[model samples]
Target: MNKKQKKMLIRILISAALLIGFNFLPFGGPLRFILYLIPYLVIGYDILIKAFKGIKNRQPFDESLLMAVATIGAIAIAIYSEVADHENGDYVEAIAVMLFYQIGEWFQSYAVGKSRRNISDLMDIRPDYANIEIGGKLEQIDPDEVEIGSVIIVQPGEKVPIDGIVIEGESTLNTSALTGESLPRDAQEGDEIISGCINMTGVLKIRTTKEFGESTVSKILDLVENASSRKSKSEDFITKFARVYTPAVVYSAIALAVLPPIVRMFVMGIPAEWGIWIYRALTFLVISCPCALVISIPLSFFAGIGGASNAGVLVKGSNYLETLSQTKCVVFDKTGTLTQGVFEVNEVHHNEMDRDDLLEYAALAESASSHPISKSLQRAYGKQIDRSRVTDIQEISGNGVMAKVDGIDVAAGNSKLMDRLGVKWIDCHRAGTIIHMAVDGRYAGHIVISDIEKPHAKEAIQLLKKAGVEKTVMLTGDSGKAAEHVAADLGIDEVHAELLPADKVSQVEALMKRNTGKGKLAFVGDGINDAPVLSRADIGIAMGAMGSDAAIEAADIVLMDDDPIKISKAIRISRKCLRIVYENIWFAIGIKLICLVLGAVGIANMWLAIFADVGVMIIAVLNAIRALFVKNL
Candidate 1:
């Protein structure tokens, strides 16, 4: 317990003891009243102060006001009963009400504190300082002060301070804080590492590529910290309900206290029994405090976001979490989203020249381009590219590259490039990407390059089906043949292929129109070209690791490990959180309405009122905290 909770517990204990001891004494009139007032003041002084402040500030419809008015009126009725009928005043009920309310408040405080600690522990990835070599000695400096391209030393067990590539040394990285996976990843020279990973085994030198504020750790921390600001629809409903419900119940309690008493004397020709009716009204007010629905709804969403972060999924806000739970159609970008995105030269076709010579010419002509197909050709050549051997490199946007290799013209691209060169090319009947090559204005050969599917890509689609998703679709810029081959292998329900960036956005818009009221549609992608489609969907899911920064920036949810399986896990977490939210809303409202009716008819007393108010709040809070346990979901 925190210090404030500890103090409240002490006050509750003291007040309960005083009330019990004073009850046993044979006290009768004002002496009994004065003694009971001691416990009341001890337990409820803060509540009374809050109530008074609420009235002073023109906000008198809160729970504190309800509690203050009910207990104070109960005391006044007891005093009047003693003065008029010589009956012993009963002051224990009033003090007991305040005592139980404080106990409930303490429980709520502790629960919120526990939830905050869980989220804090999961996001403990901020680096304190960076080690920079200065004057033949290493000095610790702020990460923000280090400029781009500066080499910084990282010792064993230190956090990577900025996003950069490893320039020297080898080490094992504990990425659990970032990815929620316990296994360490190996890092060597030329490997790109993001900030917030801990170096576990070796000393390394890193060249900073970004400032601290633009690093991954800073973006994640900023996202999580601001999540609560965007409230879900359910949370907004509770806020509106409480504003109207609290004042309406307070006015009804007033009518319950006054109208029936006047009618008994004037209409029914009977004694007005004002004391009994007023006591019932006090019980009514306590039962209608609205504490449970007001507090627990928001807490449920907060816990859900915390649990998602622990599973390596980052939800930007509670509003997105609500939308994600309603997803019925999932659209995916094929390249990096479902496939390995690593291209390999599968076969050489129609080669009239030596295989080695063909590959060397293809690699040299495309050496200046950093495209994946170029890289695959360079990898297949198995030799360092000498850029000096190539000259006059001209790149065609939709076709390919044209360059001079050893003073001979070499063109490597699709059939369109060969046609533009006025050379007859043979079309390969391969399902993979085919690149045709030309030498000295004649068709030489073609090569086949294919992307490997991810290990869990098929399983991820199946899981989405099992999780109640109605349809699964894949959108890609690859050829129709290549796209259909992957879609069939992965069991995707629909496929759209050979689309540009603008075409992807139009596809998503058409899909959204088809899903008018059925359910929301989510688009998942990992490339910079996917940002437009990601933002235009119902919910945008981006791959955090190896995904372009533009895609992550425009996405609503981020999967840290870039694993396809996490997509289903994220959906499950959202569904579970929303389930808890609806459960608390109905449970709290149902119990309070039932108890309010019973109190109106005089069948419920102040003890039952305590249960109606404080007991229900404690139960709702416990239920909200369950959203934090999502490992098995």
Candidate 2:
């Protein structure tokens, strides 16, 4: 407990002791009333002052108003009946009730403060500067001042400050900050490294392709900052309920006071004291205040969102938190999502040329290229690169590289590369790109590079199923063969590939159309090419450090590190939060309504009414706090 909690705990104990003493002490009438006034002012003065302030501000219908009226009404009975702390209860009950209510409020306040602090901590991950390589020298510059196409030097042990491609040197980057993987990935010339990753080993010269604001890390932080502005369905309901409920209860308390005495005077001819029932009616007002509902419900959502943000999951609002529990189908983007979007030469086929020779010659031909597939081949070969071996290298954008390697005309890429060379090319009957290598326009061999499936990708899918996702679909712009290979490897229920960005959106729309009943559909991606699809789905989730700003902004949920298993984890957390929300809702309303009916009929006294309102509130508020520490979900 924090300082505020500690203070409130002491206040509660003091107020409890005072109430106990008043109940059991052998004090006379007037003396006991005067004695009770000491602790009453100690515990209830703040409520009284707030009530006075609200009345002055024309906002008198608040929880403090209810507390003030209830306690003062009991004191009026003490002054009039000159009663000691005898019979059913006294002002001691009133003081104790408000004191314990403060205890719940303090606990809630502390938990929310902790959660908000976590969100602030997430903002610290955003980088401040980029080391740009201007001309021959490196310079430290503000990330925003670094324009696109600038070369940046990412020395070993430094964080990559912008998304760019490697032009010189080599390194292994610990991309765990983005992808949540434990392994470090190797990157050589021509490889694209996203910003926000720490380069664990070796120096790297990267050509900044994207501006600083457009970098992956910057976008993730910005998305998290803006997530809470959007309100959820449950949040909206609570807002409207507070507005209508507070006024209605206030009016009911007025009717309870006036209606009883008027009926007795006109119909039954009894002397209408009005004070007896008016005091009961005032106690009714106190019980009906609904502060517990108003305060704890929103506090629960605030803490849930904050807790989720700390774990690197950005839930846009409490509504998404509530909807997450009802999710049935989860659609996943294959590249950079379920699979390591980084492609590597997993298998090599040397139909005639030596495998190492083919790779060395292929890397040499593609040396001048700045593409991920080319970089993977170079990294795989890891041979002493003879730059002088190649001459007249022409890089055909979106196709392949052509070069004169060791006096032989070498070309490497897709079927289009073979077609451009006017030679017969062999297709590798597998998924991923089959880079067909040709020597002097003769079909030499082919090297297939594919995005390797994530080690936890299959397990993540299994966990999603176990967590109750009915369907797991893979949607990608990759080749059908590659999509099938990845989907089969990861055990996805459906695979759709060879799609454009627009086609991915259409697929999500179709998936949403086919969803069973009112179940929600969530589209998960790295928040890059799938921005539209992510926006179209019921819930859009982005993964890792490489996620695009557009994707993160468009996505409803973002995983700070690219971990497929977090999909299940996030769903589980939401389920827990939603369960707690429902429990608070039912528990608060159920107990309050029951006690309210009993109070009106005179079967329940003001003491039980205090139990119904403030007591149930403490229990529900405590239950709502359960969502904050439930990170295990």
Winning model by TM-score = 1
TM accuracy, model 1: 0.94
lDDT of 1 at 432: 79
Question: Could you tell me the lDDT of residue 194 within candidate 2?
Answer: 85
lDDT string for model 1 (311-392, tens) is 8888999999999999999999988789878999999876569888889999999999987889999999999999899999
lDDT of 2 at 522: 89
Name model 2 segments beyond 4 Å from true.
1-35, 83-89, 110-228, 268-273, 306-312, 346-371, 377-428, 435-447, 546-554, 630-632
Off by over 4 Å in 1: 133-139, 351-354, 388-411, 415-424, 438-442, 544-548
Best by lDDT: 1
lDDT values, one for every candidate = 0.90, 0.77
How accurate locally is residue 343 in candidate 2, as Cα lDDT from 0 to 100?
79
